[model samples]
Target: MIERPITDWLPLTMKEVEKRGWDEVDIVLVSGDAYVDHPAFGTAVIGRIMESEGFRVAIVAQPNWKDDLRDFKKFGKPKYFFGVTAGCMDSMVNHYTANKRLRSNDSYTPGGEAGFRPDYATTVYSKILKELYPDVPVLLGGIEASLRRVTHYDYWQDKLMPSILVDAGADMLVYGMGEQPLREILKLARQGVPFSSMRNINQVAFMHDARTPLADYNDWSTVELASHETCLKDKIKYAANFKIVEVESNKWQANRITQQVGNQVLVINPPFKTMEEAEIDKSFDLPYTRLPHPKYKKRGPIPAYDMIKFSVNMHRGCFGGCSFCTISAHQGKFIASRSEKSVLKEVDEITKHPEFKGYISDLGGPSANMYKMKGKDESICARCQSPSCIHPVICSNLDTSHKPLTELYRKVDANPAIKKAFVGSGVRYDLLVDDFNKNNNDGNHDEYMEQLVTRHVSGRLKVAPEHTADDTLRIMRKPSFKYFKLFKKKYDQIQEKHNLKQPLIPYFISSHPGCEEQDMANLAAETKDLGFQLEQVQDFTPTPMTVAEVIYYSGVHPYTLKPVKTAKTRDEKQAQNRYFFWYKPEYKDWIRNRLNKLNRPDLVERLLGSKTGNSGKTTSSGNYSGRKKR
Candidate 1:
């Protein structure tokens, strides 16, 4: 059970149940993939909220998320209901996994195909629910169903149709943080409330009005279908790349395929300014119950449970507005945080792990180093989910930095059993470098950086430089080279004083929006000079809901408000990647010869890309954010 603070206002239902003296209400929240005992978004937070409201909630994460008719027997029709998400919780995983088809739905499954896609999973969940529960209302909440709640575009069948409601067989969907919506639903349900009566709940995404026929699940341009077919099972893959085309006029469908099924078709709603409504203290006042996670799954490609994954969230949300990231899409614009004491408690528990050799802890969130909570008067810019902020560069509103985090690191280090603490999550270099000289209210300054080096890492710290070119990064919403230079300089000095030979790990991406040949030339040149082993070069895969993915689809960065080009072929990507290897002695001469043959002599260093993710960057959090959403 969660050990939350006493004064914080708990969910209304939680309070009501406690007041009413009820033991438990039977309820089940279903998903499409393996269950993570912890809450990434809905699992824990929503589950906790449910318990707070005095209802019993069980997360059946990662069920056979499909629209097929047969897969619904696991949790026989619950007396309460089912909650649905995509393949891997949300579009975020789909982004990281590169839109490849998952292995579960082999060629033999009725609606199965290779390459990771959440649709197949949702389809399975829907079909099973329809066949089994018949009348029990199924609610879809996660990214897959939420983002596709309208008839805007479909990547799979290459043509738009109605909402996932019809496709997945769920009666309705509640988007964003299900806290508010679920709380409302539960309160209403306990009082004998129906779905129609609970329509006014906040953060809920239901079929809008009754006039039109929302498109079908398989509706979209061929480009969308092609990529969705190839992406791995993750939430972002389904969300990243979609062009928002407004209805030509306000023409409803000629014939409503599923008349009542038509909710309003959603294009893109401004991220629900989750800030004004978010009760941070209440949100964070979770039970200090560091209990074992029975829902934890085994790791893939090796031993499943490697000392049970424990996570420490340093920050949340992205102002970077990268087209390919969905943290901005899912978590909303606000950056919420826990107090240092809270973080320390979590770390202390982690140190108690039986397998604690102290290799690494997942000290990450959307952007690990971005624990900077902004000031109260963000009056200059009210929240808008239009995919960007109107800032000149990085917003100054971020008063919360990682200084306390560093101190917590030091305290954790004080434990003799914990030999090291790695930042396994994304190091928002931009955030860390932001007031580098000015030691802030968080107690210490560069000490965090030093700890990042001397303690967490074995030798290198992974930093996502994303792309070397300014234009590309501008589109990607990542920091500029000047920032990297400063980070590298700080990193180098720290390395020298500590007599640490570890190189600063920096990752680069190829074929992002707005990348020109000269950009590739510049990247190659940068890579060759960086002098570190560049292990991996990545090709761009557009996931759903990310600004970058929009750039991939529209050929423009949503924030930059500019036109861009996506690389058209594998050969083009190969050509760009070739530059990264020119510095390796083993392949240098040969690669150099090829570069010379192409008449591009200066573009070697820029070509470097590292699979190890900037082996020089320091972090103890093993859960790294790939291609950090600006």
Candidate 2:
């Protein structure tokens, strides 16, 4: 690979392309986000990887799809193909809130602006590209394409939609992490294999005629899912399909997944194995400037870039497999950690930056303490299909040690240029509780807790408890609230021992599946007793490819296929969400009335305040006749 300056960002225009002495580009990539040449941004990482692989790549960020064909025609056509992405997050998730309200700001945009990217960004961008240059092949990837690679439930539309490739009119869809599949695709294309003939690559999905035989791909075993038409007509089949899709996704040796969308057969090849440590390190070691493209310097800072520019991602993938999360689905459940030497080298690089402030913002991944943590036996894990390693009690064969992570934290902070290193990502509090780690005889649980609370906390530590109800937590694949109680006790004890004032901010979700009004009331009363005002609360927003979303859309659990109750209506969901703000004076009367209607005065008194005897009681005559005759 040619050596480029660390400060050099990839070209964003034809002018930079000319300066590099490139007559024609091989791949012209388009995205729905402002160009930030940091590893945290997906577009930058993909472009840099392609550039390192001897391909001339140019990026068009946040292109205007509503206006003329200018943004699409800036670089004309490419020699190979056009790569399109919906930024790091799905466009619908970026544009709308959980309540389906249009969001006021986009973190991926310059100056925190909204409306720069259109709705359903991947499809919109791909459609514009095909319209302008009909013959060029368009490829789709990123979270939106990965999760929607097959028939999926759309929360905003409240309907089942076909594969995004069908809607976008793209030639191919690269699901999951794109490094391995992309390398193969580009290699095959460069060898004169047309994009249409490139159908056998792993982790790539495309459409075929219904009559096409499965034997065409003789090496892969295929599993046929219910057609998109069937899912729309019968939701039970839709729920059943999720079970097959999720199980295949986490398996080390997975089967190819197929679903019929209208008249076309959508075929998704099984993913490549989880990236090895060296492979992940190679992807991160690319020449990233770690700053937004210079064009955006005058447009105000990108909030997302500003937050993570100085941080080092020590690893990839999570094994937690929370039902409401897509991390495991997209990044795989196997943990792929960078070597300690690689991590420290990145830390040293960040320390030399002109913007370095003697502090590292974050040294973590999807779940911060999951570094170098995986099953004790690889052979056993290879054959296992269980989604979560910790849920339903931690696996006996799993290694839940925290010593390596603790050492990594110390090594990063030991640098003379650094003052402190913080773990900004949310840590799994369940792992710290004694009951969960009791089997492991490492004796480092308490020590790890002490180190975190003593040094890494930035005046506040964030952990998600999700909910207080046992039934809801079970549906969400989270441990019981009793574990949270134990973890909080430990956290508070460490703070007291060190004479520190850092607060433990717990995150909770409202209106999740299997939660009732009474459950939320219990949550309010319980947290209030713990002296928490409960600010970090959210109403559950169902995204694609999760157990919660399957249940929310089909009204049936994927594992059990039994009816699961959910709060679907706006009024029903809001009533449960209102309990989270029980500390506010404005919600006191409303909460009291709702609990009173449920005939649970015990909760009303607990959440609001205990009324004096006969002070506000009503009489049998439907009046306040029980009051004293004053």
Candidate 3:
């Protein structure tokens, strides 16, 4: 291990820039998150990538947007562009809960304080920079920009907003894992190509004047989506547009997509191919301090950084393609996993950190067991356009194996400095169920489950079944609840064999599209029968760029044009969510009343232990305390 100077981090201030002897930075990134120089932090990754590419980069993190705009003008203007992001998460999501309530604390901010960044932070920061600099190009990236690249729903505003570029007034937008497009933009800029002329980069979106002929970029075909105005007027048209966008986004060889918003055309170029092992490794292997910028030492520690400081992400992208999730939308449906050597190197680095205590918090990714798995036939995958690879049924062309991940875990455990490495991320339990995914003839599923239960059980293992109703599960793109039963049986078998007491805490969502109140009641009743008190629950919040959100706004499934009932009113949503707490005394009367109104005496009897009795309060079968609030 080597001691690092303050200069080792990407310059977060003009003082740090002066220490680096930098006269002017090539790029200045403005982010909503407090600067944590870890790869898990998007701002750090983008800034470090630029530095690795021989660009003098400086970061202005969580700048004072509400003040007299001094923070916006501090860097003056970069030589190439000013990059803007709303941190790792969408700012609205970061600021508010699913109920649209303002959260009191921000995990990305120092001292877990809220309000450091404004809502719609990317648009706010970009607008400020455009006003201040006027000439320097404003480039938008990160999840906020990536998911909102086109016409999409905004849950907070309860409206279908046009592309973020239309409001942010930026020169260009780089969506998804931005390393590939970012490098291309940098190389072209180095050749003296102006940013305005660099519109052909993949995974980049920009507003083109509708009157002008679109630039001819290779021989790629284009798919025209319904205009923003049309989507606003017609919900059916909006729903249809999402299907096209989703399919194209997941395809390996995808068509360029365009949509008219007012006088401008939004052109979203197809994404770059999933990064190769070496490509993703290069981004992770960059020189990061792996700690928050030292200036925040007095402000107190960042909660998000604290949680993952000792964790190692094994891969990028998720093929699970859960409808409610934005992971596949932003990271793509293919998995780009890190090499074993790269993961081990990171583990060793974590061991050397002063705060590490012989434990690796997580050895997982978006979905823990998706490491190094992909389609068996490249040609089939290249031509396919389905948004999900393992929905309805697992594709035979796809390879679902847990051996690579299991082996990786064992190797990490064998490290002399490591006491335990846990898989903290949510596991896709369906992939391990033999009835659902038949690709496990090698008994890898059983072996992996045994290893995970015996070694990685950090008090309890978490999984997301999302819902129990078959109709709701189908609409959510999740497998039947029967598969979850199979998975739980296997999990419990392994636990009992090893004399372990780790409970499987399953996550469920209420008020999702196609989920009626009766469905929620049935969910509560069945889980009650299975000895679950229903702890991890949420009221679905519609975010941009997901099939579920589209359905919520459109009243119809994006894939299927048929109408799907969703709880829209506040009362309807609250009613559906109340079923999760059937055992609580506060909700016992409400549950009984609601069940009686729905004519579901059977459910009431099952949930309450009797149709009228109130003394039937019981907890989950195991020591499962719900998901802890972050």
Candidate 4:
């Protein structure tokens, strides 16, 4: 927001500096992710925003998310407040600890040591923030803070975290995209605004004594909201509309106990949009710094500099709400872009780096293809008001096309300096299948997408088929196996034609609440046939606000209330995962025969192990002959 506004903004910013008790210190934003100079992610982009608005900012690449004031002090007090979040927006709930703690109970672990403490990382981080900045407010935002904004079910801790706002001791929590919220915060801070007044700002969500119900407590129904015997039938009614609720704390009506101290609600006001024409370039000319300041910390929570790639923003928000996803719950379903040229300019600067080997990493917003909405003015039937898309199948009304995004990618790869460009992040295959694969015979149509995939391939391109079965995919709010099978073949055949080594990498998850032994077995069967190495086999770990996690932990999908086949113990699932690793011929002979008897002959060879005799021979160390080490 340059022009005179940002320049004029400095005076108030100075005032904000003094209000926060700081004296022209360069604020170093620290995080636990790669703050690579490139886009994709890091403090760099936000740093640029702050810079564009006429504030001083430095980036502290991946630091231990729990680093305290002393650890972060490498740069004195941030001129404003130091920004903190779980690295790369991935919550601590997704990580496990040495104690065998799974991030969440709902997290599936077909095979790994199993205890979990989803709150562990955030808690430790909260404690550190408190220890480091005793009085200085440590603002918590990003995905973790947004989703954890309320007191809800925590699958890992098996209890609750009060609310990151109260329990975490964060002075302010900004949910959704921080641009408008951050800008407002900066403006207010510079104007010497106080914490009590932050609630009034747009895009800002604060926790108060008021709270909403647990959405649907059917599964949690058996477990009281509190230790007492009371409970509510309609949790949605109890939702603490941040706009309506205000409080320090209160008692629960249903669970009937003094509601825990942390049961307050945070008012996350609607985002502030800068509609004025000047604000357009204002986003473009934002004075925030792109590269981390010269004094880049060598070691920290976010070692972004060390990562191979980066992410740049074109927009914010996703319209596609797969039920098991949190993008809607947190960011809302809106799309915001920072000018296409702005993104390209950001890429140019990245390519300028000597260490950069011409690899222009992904260029995307929430969903890469969704750089622009389907129809700017068309009425979008938000099929499901759910945090996730309510509809299982692709909504015909929602526009899904590849024209604009295709051009963007073309412009990027066209830069001869960039040896290759890849959309490494998740590409909504359903959208791709429609826009590129639907066979409209609509001019160079298929050829266009094939080129995009070819140019973006780096070893492999990742797409989340999540599962290979229709029933499981439907439950997971994803396209069916039919779609995955079709796309996989298309990609494979195309790769063969190009003679490129690039492979189609699909991710799979096991033990989702609704999945039973047969589902897992069916997936195993698909894996054998597909011949995919499967770099990632995520077990379903339920995040607090996620519908799936709720189902797994409570033994019921909150919406369906159906008796699911969630495994109660870890041992039972680990055996299933072992199946993915056993693909040898000898093992196959035994497994195939036995699996046939088990009524799961499909998984027999893959589970027991088998081999295609035609290709390169495996050496002694890696060699095998049916079930024997020799």
Candidate 5:
């Protein structure tokens, strides 16, 4: 392996820019994350994509927003536009926990430090750029901007805020993956098209004066959502607006959406079709140092980078569309997979790293088993408006085969430089249960399970069943918990057949919409019966752009317009979460008292066991950990 020079990285400072012999840069990206030149990092990917297109790109990462305003002035202004992102994860989610407690550290920062970025970093950074530059266009991207592009709920603020464009005062916004729309934007900019005239581009959102006629570039039919003012006064109208936004977001051919907010109208164009094989491969095949910038050598490791330094993401986009998830909302429901060659090439690159440890951390995407899986029929998928392909029931048009993924894992393992490649991402367990998916008519399901358990099991295999109660599961867009039982039965058989001892860890959530105290008690009792003491649990926090979040704010399901009960108060949330730790001594008496008050002493006995000091502890079960997918 060759050592990379400092010049191998995208210029992060003026000194590095001077080394490149560039008097000025074309595009300057301001990010809330430290500059890690890896494809997994959004700032790095956007910078490299611009550089590939013959643009001089410079990055100002984790710029000081509170001090002298020097960081904003350092790069001055770019020739094209300034791109801003809140880093890999949303800043609020990074800075706060589910209980709204200020987190002590940020995984994306050097030394896992907090305070490197501000709350609503995108809005902060963009506002700063507009105030400082005043003349240059400010373009927004990344998950923070993408998910907040509409009138959505903000749990931290406990209010419904208008599109981020209104607050940020930016010229344009790119939603979703940004790669496809970015390329088109670059082409138009090269042709000398003004930034304000980019309304025709797909996946781009911007504000237009309400008094003017809305421009129709592609002649796309438009759907108007209830105004932000209307959502504030009428919760039912707010819930109804979400249904239109979600359906169009997942459709193959979608209508342009607009919403009135104050004097300006927000225009969000339909997204481009999913990326093809060569297109997605191009994004991954760019020149990357695959390391954090050298300036961070003494600051300690970025926890997010360290976790994925040896991993390979085979694809992007998740079709699971869980109610609490933002994956489909931001990445779209369609899958954009790389060619097998691209994935294997990335694996080879990992093995050549100087810190190569003969182990690959993850060889998965948004969901581990969703590689190369999509709708079996193109026309059917085009006409489909459903957000989840495998929730409630698996779509007959969907292809749930796991053969390609199984074969890919074998190829990676066969590389003599690699000792093991584990799938660290959460696997969609329902896809493996034949009773639910019914698409695994061939032996692919069993064969994939055997391969995964025998080779990829890194002590335990984690799956997310979310919750146990059927009523709660329905609102979560999850299959019945019975399917999880069948999946577990099959998983255990595979383990026994292979003579392996890997524990199967399942995750659950409390305080989600449609869940009640009795439902939580049932969850505790049912899991206790399985000889497991649950450790993986979380109280649901409502984030923007999710169905559960809408329900939490509006008190009704967006799809059905029916009232759904949610645990919102601190006491209510705490009560539901306590059920997860029923085995802990501190919570043992509380569980007994709470269950007795609910008038179900049977639950107290089932969870805490007979009063003769039955500890309710599992002798040899693995501890479950909670998952909060951003």
Candidate 6:
């Protein structure tokens, strides 16, 4: 391999573009995030990938859309096309909270500033580029476009919107991680193929006339979903469409999906196969500066960059497939892990950084322990249509071993330049429990748990139980709280054995679909009995392309079409959310009153102390036996 300059970050400005003595760029990328030349940021990865392919790529980060349109015209137009993304996260998630309130700061922005990027950033930027450069093709990618590729639900607007490709008036949209499809698209463009004629690429979505012929489109069985007009008039059809969308997304062999938005047809080409190990390893091995762009020096640090600057990602995609999560929808359920050699090389690169702090903040991916994890039988997995591999019960064919991840952890910690390496990503505790891994012979569940508790944890290990009630957990596609209890017991025993005082932080969600006020109260009482103050909790937010969101909006579960009770009104949501803060003095009276009205005075006594002050009387079922104080 030849050596390249360590500081070879892609150009971010016209002056930097001129420094390379290039009069024109082949590709100009636009992003909603501040320019950070790190792999963690999607725009940087795309820019670096294009550069490595011998294309002159320049980036326009967080361009001022409300200004005189100077930012859009800064690069004039690229020879190939303009790539747009809403940064690493979806734009709405970046700008607002679950309660629909605007956030005070954006972690992706320098100095944690807010308002740098507009809402619906991909659509906004794409529209602006089309307005300025009418002839230039606008290509949309990233989480925003990927999730909103077809007619889907929009939480902020509380409506079923058409595909973003239609709304933005862009030529095409690239869904999922763009490396594979993007390379093919650029290659076709170089061969003199026009953008309008480039609809055959996999993982790409585009609009076509409803009456277009399909016979000439090659070998692909097309599945037409309910039209956008029908979905707008009836949400049940919309919910039904998502079921098909999710199933096709995870299958090894899937049919091309099409939907009609009025007279125009929105066609989503089936995604390419999951990136092989070598392919994903190559992506992580790109020449990233591993630092923020120099232009952001005066703007203070980008919070998102600073958090993961010293960290490393070992894999991509998640198979857990929680109902509220979009990871499976975008990245797919297939886990694509990087080679150990590739990961260790990146760690060595981090050690050489000038700002090395003798610490690696994280060494994990979407789910920490899911590295190299997949189905034991490839044939079964290829035909499997289940959204979650571990849900309902861990699949017998799935490989739930933690040995690879445990060995990788030891290798990273052995580096002399590193003092400690922590696992910051949320771990799926169910995978670590013996009950869940009983089917696998060499799972080494005990060893992995011991190693994680003894080494990787930084004072506390975080896990997402999501909810305590079995009904809610089932709806969330998460394991029951019984597994949580078993995991906690083992965790406590491990802590005691090591003489360590690390706390197990469990995350929970309030006001989720199928969760009643009683469920929240039960959660509070159960967690309180376990001696948890319950600091980390959230009210469920309804995002697009998620089962929970479908249930929230349609009032019917997508899988069974059964009516799912959801807290829609502010008062109902607030009432359930208050139970999460039962320890607070102000909420105590409110919780007590709410429980009392439901004829559950026992919960009030359990959550709130009685006059006798013995923390109330405990029943055989672990709940308080006494009634509320008069």
- Candidate 1 residue-wise lDDT, 254-339, digit = tens: 11111133233322222233433135434544552333233231323111122225556655565545555656555655565656
For candidate 1, give the lDDT of residue 75. Answer: 37
- C-alpha root-mean-square deviation, each candidate: 9.6, 6.8, 1.6, 9.4, 1.2, 4.7
Model 4: CA > 4 A from native: 1-42, 56-83, 90-138, 209-266, 270-304, 308-315, 364-366, 376-391, 434-447, 496-501, 533-536, 584-598, 601-630
Each model's lDDT comes to 0.52, 0.85, 0.89, 0.52, 0.90, 0.86
Query: Could you estimate the TM-score for every candidate?
Result: 0.72, 0.95, 0.98, 0.72, 0.98, 0.96
User: Model 1, poorest ten-residue lDDT window?
Assistant: 246-255
For the record, the alpha-carbon RMSD of candidate 2 to the native fold, in angstroms, is 6.8
Score candidate 3 by lDDT: 0.89
Comparing 4 with 5 on lDDT, the higher-scoring candidate is 5
lDDT tens per residue, model 6, 1-630: 113442376878788888788999898999999888888889988888888788999989999899678887888778989999988888998888788999999988989999999999999999999888899899999999999999888899998899999889999999988889988987898898998888788899999987876444658898889999999999899889989999998888888999988888899998888999999887888988788887787888888888898999999899988999988888899999999999999999999887888899888888888998988889998889999998888998888888898899999989998899999888989988887657557658788888899989987787888789999999999998988889989998998998988777777888999999899999988887877776546888888889999999999999988899999999999998888777676787687777889999888888887635644323321222111000
lDDT tens digits by residue: candidate 3, 518-615? 99999988887788876557779888999899999999998878999999999999999888888788998888888898898888888886745556
lDDT of 2 by residue, 1-630 (tens): 123442376778888888888899999999999988878899998999898889999999998788676888899899999999999898998888889999999889989999989888999999988988999999999998898888889999988888899999999999888999999998998898998788888889999888766545647888999998999899999999998998888888889999988778998888888888898888888877777887876788898888887888888888888998999888888888998988998899899888789989888898888898887888899888999888888888788888998888888878999999987888889989888666558777777788898989876787888789999999999999999889888887888888987777777888899999899999987877766776546788899988999999999999999999999999999899888787666777898888999999999877777644322221111110111000
The TM-score of candidate 6 is 0.96
Better candidate by TM-score, 3 or 5? 5
User: How much is 550 displaced in model 4, in angstroms?
Assistant: 1.5
Which ranges in model 6 have alpha carbons more than 4 Å from their true place? 1-7, 215-218, 611-630
